[model samples]
Structures are given as C-alpha cells and as structure tokens.
Target: MIAQRYSYLSWLPLLLVSSSHPQWPSSWRCIPQPARSSVPCYCSGRQTWAGSLCGTLRIPGKRKRNEIMLRYVVALSLLALSWAQDCQVANINVMQNFDKTRYAGTWYAVGKKDPEGLFLLDNIVAQINIEEDGKMTATAQGRVIILNNWEMCAHMFATFEETADPAKFKMKYWGAASYLQTGNDDHWVIDTDYDNYAVHYSCRLVDADGTCLDGYSFIFSRHPTGLRPEDQLVVLQKKTDLCLLGKYRRVAHTGFCESGTSLDPQ
Candidate 1:
C-alpha cells in the first residue's frame, strides 16, 4: 500500500514544474469516482490508492493531460483538507465557563450567515437581559420582508434554557407580531471577549453524516459601527473554526429599525 501511495505522488514533480506557468488549459477535467466504487484504476491508468479512484479525465492533448493531472492532485489535496476539518455539529467546540452576566447587553449584528428562508434582512440588533432569577432572555429587531413583499421592522424575543454546557442553550424564540417567524433553535456561543465581539451559531437541521444541514450564525459587536481592528482577526479565526469563514455577509445598520414604531423590549 505504501509503494502504491508513493507511485501515486510521483506526479508531484511534474506538478511543481508546471506551477510557474501563467495559465492552465481550461479544457482539462478531472472527475473522481465514488468512494464506494470498485474501480481498479486511477488517473493515467494507475492503480487506485488510499481506497479511492479517479475517473477518466478528458484532455485535448498530452500537454493538456499533464496539466489536468496537476489539477487533479490539487483537488485531492483539498479534499483531504476538508475531511480534516470535521464539521460534525456535535463535535464543534463552544466557549468555556460562559458568563451570562457580562454577555447581557446590546449587540449589533455586524455579520450574519442566514439559514434557509431567512427572515431578517439587515439592520439587526439584539438586546440580552438577565432576569432577577438569573434567567437569560433576549429581544432583537431587524428589517424583514413579510407577505407580498411588505417590508417592516421585526421585533423578536427569545428565552434561553440552560444545558449541561454553559455555552450551549436551547433557545425558544418568537416574534412580537403573529406574522413573523417563531421556532426553537440551538444557540451556541462559539467565542466571545464579552466586551467587544461575540460569535453565535444555531443548527436547525442535522444531516445523516452528523453535519449541520441548515443553520445560521451571527457576528455580534458591542458597537453598531463594526468590530475593532484587533477583534477582526480573532472573529475571523472563530468563523473558520465553525467552518463558516466565507459564508457570511455584512449585516448593515442604516437606522431602519430605529426609526420604526415597534416597541423595544426593556
């Protein structure tokens, strides 16, 4: 098996030589076979390695074939990296010894990863309050489009139920108005500094592979303007840890909700 793996990586020398080329031919293609397939060969008629196989790649000529093989090698490397990420929702880590007292305050949504059928569009702000009994509840305001494209500021409320993990909570949320969205969600505090920024994640659906099928995330900041320059890198690393680095969009605040008549929860 080791010898076969070494033979497979022998193409790396050619890949290194071609790395300096300005452009690769777009006509090259590499289609890998299913992992469960019993295929006997790989690229260039080589035996399959690591229990995986590559399907026949189409190229116009010998030069294009070599370039395409280089791309195939890069694709394999990326696949390996993705597998190492371990995106299983149950395996994801959260903050340790979370303090709800310090977390209670106004948080502006600087960035968000919307789930399917996103309700909130922008100008999102959430206020967390801890009751006298040490229970956590929150209210949020955001601009949303309702029936027949009627845009309005949505006021939502949520109550958190404690769990075995301090950073993880079961959130029961509802809208101030009956027409808005309401449901239960898993609220996990991925990371936070309790003063500058906070990262929150929720998975509404789980796939068979133990990965998040449908989910949303929020990058919260104490200031509505945005995260501090020093906090940006830390938040970026937390986003990467959640496997949602590039899936977020900036949540803008243009005073849309502030101007509305909706009562802000106190």
Candidate 2:
C-alpha cells in the first residue's frame, strides 16, 4: 500500500491576503497542508510544516482541495526559480570561436577538481579526434584505484553532441566494458588556447539551495611536462572565472597508465 506522503500539508493556513498588506515578501505565499498522514514531508530551506505549529483555515467543500493544489503549484514554481538561479550563478563562460580541428590532439590532464563518484585517479590523458563526418570523439586513459585498494587502468570513450555554441557539448561516454564507467554529461570548454592549454568545466547536479551538488573541472596542456608559466596564469584566471580557483589538485602523469602491471582486460 502506498502512503499519502503530502497528506499533512492540509493543516496549513490557506489565508487570502488583502491588497492592503504591502510588506509581504513577493516570493512567499501561504499554502495548504495535506490531510492526515504519517509520512514525513520535506521541502527546501526547511520550509516544511513538520514539527511546527500549523494553523488551519476552515474552507468548506471543493475550495479546500483547490487551495491544496494551488499550494503545490506555487511550491513547484519556487523550486524552478531556485534551480534557474543556481544555474546562473554556476555558469562558466566557454571559449569563443572554438575550432574543433585545432583542439583535436592528445592532451594531458595536469590538474583536476573532481566531482562525486570520480573514477579517474591520475595519469589522465585524452586523445580527441574529429571523425570523417566532422563529429568529435575522444578516448581517455587514466589510472584508477577502486574498492579494497584495487588498481587498474581505465580506458574511456566519448562521443560529443554539438550545441548551438561551438564550445559547449554534451558528451556521452562509456568504458571499453560494461563493468567500467558510463554516463551522459555536459562537456564545456571553459577556455582553451587550442595548442598550449585548456580549461574544462562540467556541473553534474545542482541543489535546491542554489548550489552545485556535483561538478568536475580539468586543466589540460599539450605538453606532457605541464603548462608553461604564461599559460599557467591564464588558466588560473579562467579557473577563478569558473568559481573553481584553488579548488583543484595537481594530476600527475608518471607513466602509471603506460605500465602493464595494472592493465585491465580490453
């Protein structure tokens, strides 16, 4: 049997405010509490009426249900507003006039700010290529240490879907086998020098509190040794612009992926 989760929302005071009350918060409104139920209710910003004194207004007949539905509609609207605000705050500016041709090549991940469920440990290297049909594809190899301290080389492949903006792409990626990584994620080229260095950003999930719950960013360089002094400063500024300055750690490429000892079956 399914329990009515929002039934407790019927206890709220569904007051009809007069136009004379001028100081009311524009975004705040009274919503009806649901009827009798044991299921707990929760909302963003601790807005739930649970464990609090909830007053009720006596509205007879169909008007009662209508008011309850209205409350739900308003709640959903506020949630959408919060989501939009989070996106605006978290957005990072991508490259302008980004040429996929120039960007295609083997690039090394010199630094990374990993998100939740990070699979790539170190020695991260990616080879980007443009297909005959002009589609962009990538193959990434990295060293990963999983549960019980088990270590292996992770080989990943990704196909990019172009957006209206040249620098923004939706990446669908999967590992060589089913036991490895798989997901569709945003892949934004935040800023890239094409040949020397590049900054990448991706936000996986946003919370109702107008914040990112999960996100990842990378600093890539053409040379295996790492970015030059001039390029490093440029990358730092771009990182600051993306709100990820000082949030990253250096990713070492010390032939860990090249070694055969931790190799996975192809």
Candidate 3:
C-alpha cells in the first residue's frame, strides 16, 4: 500500500480556549481524548469525534497537572475509575451510514472530558490510514502530563467493517466495554457516500446480539477541512455527526494532505 506523511502543528499560543456543543448525559462526564490538553472538552471517552484529540490518562504526571486535570475533567483511564460507575451502560450500534475514506486525515485537539478523568493530547495530531489490510492504523503525537511535560507518540490499531456495507461503514478504535456503557451501544455508521463528500457516524443504546450495552458515534466528511464560517451562516450549515465538529477539524491536514506545496514539512 502507498503511504504519505504531512506537516507538524506550528506552535501557536491560543487566543482563547474553544468549547464544544455537546449534550452531556447527567451520568457521564466529559474528558479530553488526549493525555495532555490546555482546555477541557466534553466527550463520552469511548467514542472520539472525527478529527479531535483523544488520549486516556495512562501515566500520572506532576502532582499539579494531575490535580488540575482531575478537577475539571472525568477520568476514564486506569488511574481514576473508582469515583464513577454508579449507573448502567446502554448498548447500541451507531455507525450504519458513516463513510470511511472521507474520515481519513489529521485532526487537531479541540476538546475532551470523560468520567475516567480529564485527558487532552496537547499539540496533538491523529493520523488514520485505511491500509490494504482493511484495518485502520492510527499514529498520534502529543504530550502526556508529567512532572515536567511528557511528549509522547502512540500507535493504535482499530478494526472496521468486515461485513459492513462499503458505501456506509463503521469503525471501532478503542475503550473498554464498561467505559462505553451509558453511552452509545456499539458505535454505528448508518449512512455515508464516498463521492458525495459528506456523511455521518452514528451509535446506539443496544448491540445487535444484546449481550452488551455501550455505544458511540463519530461522523466524517469527504473533504478534509470543516465547513467554512460564512457557509455556516448561509448555505453551509454546521452539519451534525457523532463527533460533531471534532471529526471535521484538521481533517484537511491529517496523515497525508490531499494536495499541497509540501507533503513533508521539516
């Protein structure tokens, strides 16, 4: 299979922290997907948006960063499971129509928060590839909260629809079943059109077999970048997806940019 690489995030001091439009369940808390992040965002932990940053708290960092992160965000990692899990988790398939190829690319970290605790992959990047093997390979670079600052690189594998319709496919990247409960049942993708340049990822509260419950969803687009601001006010409305705008953010800048002045930026 052919492969390509892209550019790194230019260090930019933020003007302000960006928040998301998420409908959080009372029982679930939001957490940053990445291990290190500046601002806290709301997410279910099990399912990540299309192009947003995502990482669980794997290693404890400085006492300060740990305390600060836990105050505002949920803990889904091994370090912080004792405080939550008071309710039952729902199960469902949420990706029946979402497209796959359109979802490939680099996405930046916007926001995240979960019960497992707060995690943000600061200076983060997600590189997803649909290889000949049909399995998705994810390469990510970000910082883990440590005594100083731990910049980490992680490689993860996700399995996609083997029996799913190619037209509308689904993908499962991670998270344990318990963490996924009370969220989307099974992370489904009900609709997607590769040539159409648009589609979404969906999840449910139940599984096909009914053995487990915990679902999530993440929508994607054929185009890399998100809908333009002017388009949102007029012709282009902010389309909805499982991951919301997170999936589309930085999509144009992922694993391999569609076209550019330089594919490898040093």
Candidate 4:
C-alpha cells in the first residue's frame, strides 16, 4: 500500500504542470481513499477531483500561514505607531513673532520638569542680555544639591547661538567653576508672553524606539512667587500642547541663590 502511494505521488508534479489550472485552492483536502474507489483523491467540501486520476498530495497548513502573516502585520503596526508619537513630539508649537530684544530680561523658574543629569534643583533664575556685538547671552543661577547631600549656590552662564528662527537657540552653558552644568544643548522657546510667562523645552537625546530618552522643560514667570492665575492657565495649556501635561513640579524661589553663602565642589 505504501509503495502504491509513493507511485501515485511520483506523478503529481507532472500532473500539476500539465493542468490548465495549476493553482491549488486553500480549502483543498487530501482523501486517502474515496468511498466508491480504492484510490486516493482530492476533495474540497462536497466537490472531489476526477476519481483515481487525482494524485496523492499534502495540503499546506492554513493555520500556520495565518499565524505568520499576523506577526508581520503586528510588527508593522507597532513601528508606525512609534513613528507617529515621535513626530507629534518633534513638531511642537512655538511663539510667533518672538522679539529677542523684548524677551531679554530676568525670568524666574516657576515650574520645572527635570530630566536625568539636571544640575539645577530649585530657586532658579535667569537674566538675559544683548551683548555689544548684538549677540544674546544669559546668566542663570540656581540652588543645587550635589552628592552626599552637599548643597551649594550654582551660577551658570550661557551664550545663545542664533538659528534661522528667532525663537529657537542653541545654548552653550558652563558653571562659574568646573563643577556645575556644562554642555551645548538645544533650547527652544515654546511660547512666551514676553512680560508674564514663558515655556521652554529641551530634548537631549532620542532613543531607538522614537521616544525622547532625556528631556527637560521649564515654565518661567517674571514674578518670583509664580504665574498669575490667567497666565498660569495659558502656560498650562502650552505645556499640554507640548505633551508635557502633569509632568512638572512647582519651583519655589526662597532666595536660596541670592544668599551670600556659596560652596565649591571638593
């Protein structure tokens, strides 16, 4: 019987090549032997192929094929979703018609969302100035807590490199000494009311998964206490637009940076 089956299968390739319609339907099933015949046959539901002329064949597994296709589809969907989230975060809104001259002044950090390696902790303040060469520069001072619970007043300075857009800048900053913040980082002005409040953002690094690995944002106000109620609502809305809603903590200005006491890193 096994020899006879082998003989039947040997002619299958030739039969398939000679058939006018060689494509096999997915629903096809192989029958070992038909009810009225002593030969193997091919049947789909109630329909059977021509008698013993039908060759012995193995039908492919539909379930296995479906599983493989499903995996490919799921992987593509996840990749697309990751790209979309990255694009949404990258195309953030910024202040229109931002005048750097008008924007130059003292600003207080009223709210902050710190990322990894953040040097400034609280009592943050910044003073912006227009240099004689018409370049923008800033001095920022804040209270920082270092390793082993050591606290100190940190005075940092930054020079802005202008981009095509007036509202965006590349800030190169360093501490007054060797132990403070030092890096050239992207600085974007999300939105600013000039006199009342401002929203700033920085994306330090992006991950392979199309998400920000290290990023920070600051909500600034002209007053040390914090933003006014009306200004707060505007700043909060801008924060939400940047996808940073509920990520910030209130920054208190208790004159920590202004105190005469200063400690240098050992």
Candidate 2 error regions (>4 Å): 1-90, 262-266
Return the lDDT, model 1, position 253: 94
Over 1-266, each residue of candidate 1 has an lDDT whose tens digit, in order, gives: 12233344543443443344426443433346753355543434333342333343332445654666778879999778767998889999999989999999999999999998747889999999999999999988998887677778888999999999999999999887876778999999999999999999999999999989999999999999999999999998888788888999999999987676453443
For each candidate, what TM-score against the reference? 0.71, 0.65, 0.32, 0.65
Q: Rank the models by lDDT, top first.
A: 1, 4, 2, 3
Sequence-dependent TM-score of model 2: 0.65
lDDT of 4: 0.74
Give the best candidate by lDDT. Answer: 1
- Error (Å) of candidate 3 at residue 230 is 5.3
- What are the per-residue Cα lDDT tens digits for candidate 3 across 94-155? 33454455656654432221222322233335566788875554544433343355323322
Output the TM-score of candidate 1. Answer: 0.71
Candidate 1 residue 211 C-alpha distance from true site, Å: 0.2
Please say which candidate is ahead in lDDT: 1 or 4. 1
The per-candidate count of clashes, in order, stands at 0, 8, 69, 0
Candidate 4: misplaced stretches above 4 Å? 1-87, 263-266
Indicate the residue-level lDDT of 229 in model 3: 46
Residues 52-165 of candidate 4: C-alpha lDDT, one tens digit per residue = 544444443445444544676798896675456433545776778888898899999989989887478889999999999989999888888877787788888899999998
| lDDT digits (tens) for residues 1-266 of candidate 2 | 11234233434332232112334333332233454423333321224333322222232234444565588789999667545542443455789999999999999999999987747878999999999999999999898876678888888999999999999899999886566768898899988888899999887886776556788988999988999999988998787676666789999988977777454547
lDDT of 2 at 121: 78
lDDT of 2 at 75: 94
lDDT of each: 0.79, 0.72, 0.34, 0.74
